[model samples]
Target: MKMPFFTSFILLVLITQIAIRRTSYKIESKEADFWEKERKANFTRKKPLDNLNYIKIPLDSLPFGKLDDDESRYCEKVIRSLADQKVVNLTGFTNTDLKLEYGAPNITELTKYDQNYTTLVTNLQKWGKLLYDAELYNEATTVLEFATDTGTDVTATYKLLTDLYQNKLTLSDSEKKEKISALLPVAEELRSLSKDQIKRLLTESL
Candidate 1:
């Protein structure tokens, strides 16, 4: 039995729509399954910090197995002195006393010690800036170089050094231009700093 033309066309359209709907449903299901699996995998993975066994060690005990007996003894004495000062208010002994008692070197002696001393870097950077502000360019350059070479913001140090060479000291105009050109990259990186900070740095450096 042959159907009417209109009925035949209607049936063909309905079949095409159903087939498209089925294919779309399958694609959506696959995407949903993929995302669900990804979420599960992510949840199962260990976090980076959680997997770090070194963090389990005490902060004072970090970089373990790196220190020798003398270094370890010096570190312990320093820690003890700090703790005593904080807990017992024992402030009679000067830093020199502590160094003598621990047989540890003083600042000058320890200048050649491990370059990773955060406190030393802080002090040197502070002193460097003070000297720079006092118009002592040579001394400031030496201190700042020590601080920056030992890993305290090399970019800032370079910028300051360049400024000192350009504006503060007696460099020739050609030399000043050369130094400024050399420091352009460092300045670009530090351009994100506040205008006030940039001005303060330039003022001290010059």
Candidate 2:
């Protein structure tokens, strides 16, 4: 016997819905699998250094001698052991070695290192501000000549430097007045500023 028209229509709709649900489920499963694989690959490719402990040694504390091979090997072993245990503090060893190596009543090597870094940063800040104010953008690049690595404020410094170079030729008296006029609104919005902030604003204007 032939099926009634309404029954056929309902069966056809049920089949179509089932097919659509199956297709959707397959697509979702494929996406889930792809993301899982990507996650696993990223985990596998992570740097070993990220999980390893690093030993910071003052330059003076490093044992210097072509013949002290055994001592050097021992130090390397100690560093490896600390890395394995994820204990990064090596200040005790570094301090002891500093005394042994320097043999003088003076500032520790680590203190000197810190002072040098502080001096560099201070000089960079001063020079950067002066160059920004003087509109001597080309000369300002010298401030970052020794920058070996990027840091929090370093990118901003670089950006300001680039802007300075791009706008160096445009700093004639009339142009200066025009540029200052344009920046007035921004200065109003940011009413208070440190020396560095003012330098940044001027550099960015370039």
lDDT of 1 by residue, 1-206 (tens): 45698899999999999999999999999999866754554444222222211101122522222323554445434433332221111123333333433333332332323222434444455545556766778766665654433334434565667667767888887777665564444334332333345445544544
Q: Which stretches of candidate 2 lie over 4 Å from their true place?
A: 1-107, 148-156, 169-206
Q: Which candidate is the best by TM-score?
A: 1
> C-alpha displacement of 17 in model 1, angstroms?
27
TM-score versus the correct structure, for each prediction: 0.31, 0.27
What's model 1's overall lDDT? 0.48
Instruction: After the best TM-score superposition of candidate 1, give how far the Cα of residue 173 lies from its true spot, in angstroms.
Output: 2.7
- Model 2 Cα RMSD, Å? 19.9
Local distance difference test, per candidate?
0.48, 0.43
User: Which digits, one per residue and each the tens of the lDDT, describe model 2 over residues 78-186?
Assistant: 4233323322322223333333333323224344543444343344444454555665554454443222121213334545544554465446766655644443343
**Candidate number with greatest lDDT:** 1
